[model samples]
Each structure stands twice: as structure tokens, then as C-alpha cells.
Target: MEAKQLNIGDNVKKFRELKGFTREQMADYLNLSVSAYGNIERNKTDLTVSRIQQIAEILEVDLAQTLNFDASQVFNITHNEVIQGMHSKVENHNHPDEYKEKYIKMMENEIARLKKLAGEA
Candidate 1:
């Protein structure tokens, strides 16, 4: 199987959406124009570590998580099982559902926390 490529821009976009932040809000917070912020999400900008750190801080996510976010693993939990020819994937394994639920809950909590922080700020 080919290794999946990680895209920091995509991850940043995901986190921003999860936090219920609009592009305008993010751009304003970063003192950037909307088009400039859009470039970041489109992977048109070559991001530096400092920029990545700034984005992570703004999104309220850990730098490591932002750098390492894998959409396939998170969204396609049965990928490995399918590759192995396991036809009874969902029925045979409840892990995916549990994991997805937990992940959703975690994101929800994070969103709430960010909202509270924003209110405070």
C-alpha cells in the first residue's frame, strides 16, 4: 500500500472548521487578508514551522496533532481490513464506530473549549 501524504494545510482547514471558525475570523485573528488565509488552506503558501505553530495555536490544537493529522485513518478506519479482504468489517469490529464517536466527542469538547476561550478573550 502506498503511504498517504499528510497535508498541513488540509489539517489546518479541518481544525478551523471543527472549531466553527470562518475564514474571515481566522484571517482577522492572524492579521491576514482572506485571500492570504485562503492560500494557506489551498496549500499555495509554503508554511514555516513558526507559521504552523501559529496556526495550531489559533486552532487550539497541538502542533504535533496538526502536523500528523491523517484523514484516511480517521475517516476510513476499515481501510486496513478492506485491504486484507475482510468482508465483515463493520459487523466484526466495533472499534471504528467507538473510535469515531470518541473522536467526534473530543472535537465537540474542543470546540466548546475554544468558544469559551474566545468569549473570555
Candidate 2:
């Protein structure tokens, strides 16, 4: 039952292929260019939790599985109420301009941290 240490990108490709989804189809669904999606599948870009969530949703898999994370650990990290609130705020577009900018910068910094963790920066 052992498997190769495939990264998230590898898992994504495996599931996408298994589910009969074309690369172009996934790219369109994610609103990304074909090349951009290719880079993601190749693990050439920093993978974000949100992006992983989107992929997992698209492929009908668990986000924890998509990230190769333990279910309990992933839930603790990804299911924080504060983080969820931030996402809701961003999505709902209810924040004022200044708050929006501040949140954007904070998110940018977090993405940078994620990139560093992934060794993409």
C-alpha cells in the first residue's frame, strides 16, 4: 500500500485524469490560463490552501487529502474561525476601502509565507 511521495500537484493531475477532465477544462473552471494551470499541476507555483480547496472541490475529494495532510491537523489549520471570517469578508465585499486594502496586504504577506514554505521563493 505504499505510494510515491507525490506532491499536491501530482495528486491533482492523477485525480483530474482519473475523472476524465481535460487540462483546458480545469483551467477554464479555475479562471486561469492553460499555461498557469499547467504550472500549478507541475508544482512550479506556490500552492495556496484556497487554491487547493478549489481543486479538491472540483475533483470531489477532501481538501486534506488534496494537501496530503492529516484530516485532524488540516481541519485545525484550515477551519479556524478567524481565517474563515477573513475569507467571508473578502468574498462578501463588505469591507471599506481602507480595510480592504489592509486585508489584501495581509493576504499577500500570507501568500508570500506559503510560497516560502513551498520553496517557490
Candidate 3:
């Protein structure tokens, strides 16, 4: 069986959504136009290593994790499972509920810190 190709843009989009960030927020943070930022998520732009690192920092994930993101590792099987006997296997790497709670708390704290910085500016 051929290995599935990983899409970095899709990975970025998923991570961004998980962190409760809007495209506009990310664009503002990166000082890019919204359309320019959208190009990254849409894979229209060829990303550099530095760009990937910057995105990883914004997503609060390690660069390696961002590159290796597997949706099945995080998403609940029941929610994404296909009906009609087409089995979609999801391997649980971390306890989804616990992991999500911790991640959400971290993101919330980060958001507050950014807001404070924005206010001070």
C-alpha cells in the first residue's frame, strides 16, 4: 500500500483551528495580508523552513510535531468514522479529552498574553 501524502497546509489549518485562532488573527500576528496568509493554508505559497518554524511557534507546537501531524491521532473515531463497514482506524496517542483541555488552557493563556501586548502597543 502506498503511504498517504501529508499536506503541510492542511496540518497548519488544523492546528490553528485547534488553538482557537482565526486566519485574521494569524495574519495580524505575522504582519501579512489575510490573503497572503490564506495562501499558506491553501498551499499556494512555497513555504520556507523559517516560515514553517514561525508557523509552528504561532501554533504553539514543536516544528517536528507540526510537520508530522496526523488527524487520526487526535480526532475521535466516533466523530470521523465512516459508516457502511468502511473502517477508519484512529490511534489514540494522548487521551483526547485531557489533552484537549490542557491545550485549550494553554492557548487561552497565550491569547490573553497577546491581547495584553496588543493593548500596550
Candidate 4:
């Protein structure tokens, strides 16, 4: 089965609504036209990494929280091994515990990077 595409823009919009910020308010904060901000929330325009971080801060959310990265994508993963005739192919060699550790490490590193960027801004 194919994994469904997750839109980061939707997540950002949801968090914005949760924070009670209207499009106009957010656009004003970002110094962008309402149309531009609307496009972003609607996933019409590509947003830069810094812009995403700014939005996350505006909504008082962690950048990682806004991103919602999955273990499979962030870390190399395989579900199982495939046996075809005499040939065997390993899907993912990492154990569940290993994935967990990598997940935690990745999250921590990302959070730290964002914090550093925020400090510089």
C-alpha cells in the first residue's frame, strides 16, 4: 500500500486556527498579503524552511510538531523480507528499538537546530 501524502500546510493552518489567528492576523505578522498567506495555508505556494519555522513560532508550536515526520521517512526502514524463489531480499534491517532510538535522536537534533535558528532571528 502506498502511504498517503501528508500536507504540512494543513497542519500549519490547523495550528493557526487553534491559536485563534485569522489569515489577516497571521499575514500581518508575517508581513505578507492575505492572498500569499492564504495560498500558503491552502498549499498553493511552496514555503521556505525559515517561513515554516516562523509560522510554527507564531502558532506557539514546535517545528518538529508542525512537521510530523514519520519514522519510515526520516529513518531508512523496511517492513519485512521478501522471498522470491531462491533469492531473499531484506526490507528493513533495523529493529524496532533501533528505530525508536533514531527517532528520538532525530527529533532532538531537529529541535535543537530550530532553537538555534530562533535565537539568531
lDDT of 1 by residue, 1-96 (tens): 998766778778876654546798778767799999999988889988888987877665678767887544454432122212223322234355
lDDT of 3 at 81: 18
For model 1, what is the alpha-carbon lDDT of residue 82? 21
Q: Give the C-alpha lDDT of model 1.
A: 0.67
In model 2, which range of ten residues has the least summed lDDT?
Answer: 76-85
List the RMSD of every prediction in angstroms: 16.7, 16.7, 16.0, 17.3
Tens-digit lDDT string for candidate 2 (56-85):
877656886776633232212211121221
Compared with the true structure, the alpha-carbon lDDT of candidate 2 equals 0.63
Each prediction's number of clashing residue pairs: 0, 0, 0, 1
Top candidate on TM-score is 3
**Least well predicted 10-residue stretch by lDDT in candidate 4:** 77-86
Clashing pairs for model 2 are: none
lDDT of residue 68 for candidate 4: 71
- List candidate 4 stretches off by more than 4 Å: 1-4, 69-121
lDDT tens string, model 4, 9-44? 777765554344578877877889999999987888
List the candidates ranked by lDDT, beginning with the highest: 1, 3, 4, 2
Rank candidates, TM-score, best first: 3, 1, 4, 2
The runs of at least 3 residues in candidate 1 whose Cα sits more than 4 Å from the true structure, single-residue gaps closed, are 1-4, 70-121
lDDT tens readout by residue for model 3, 3-54: 9765788778777766556798778767799999999888788888898998
lDDT-better candidate, 3 vs 4: 3
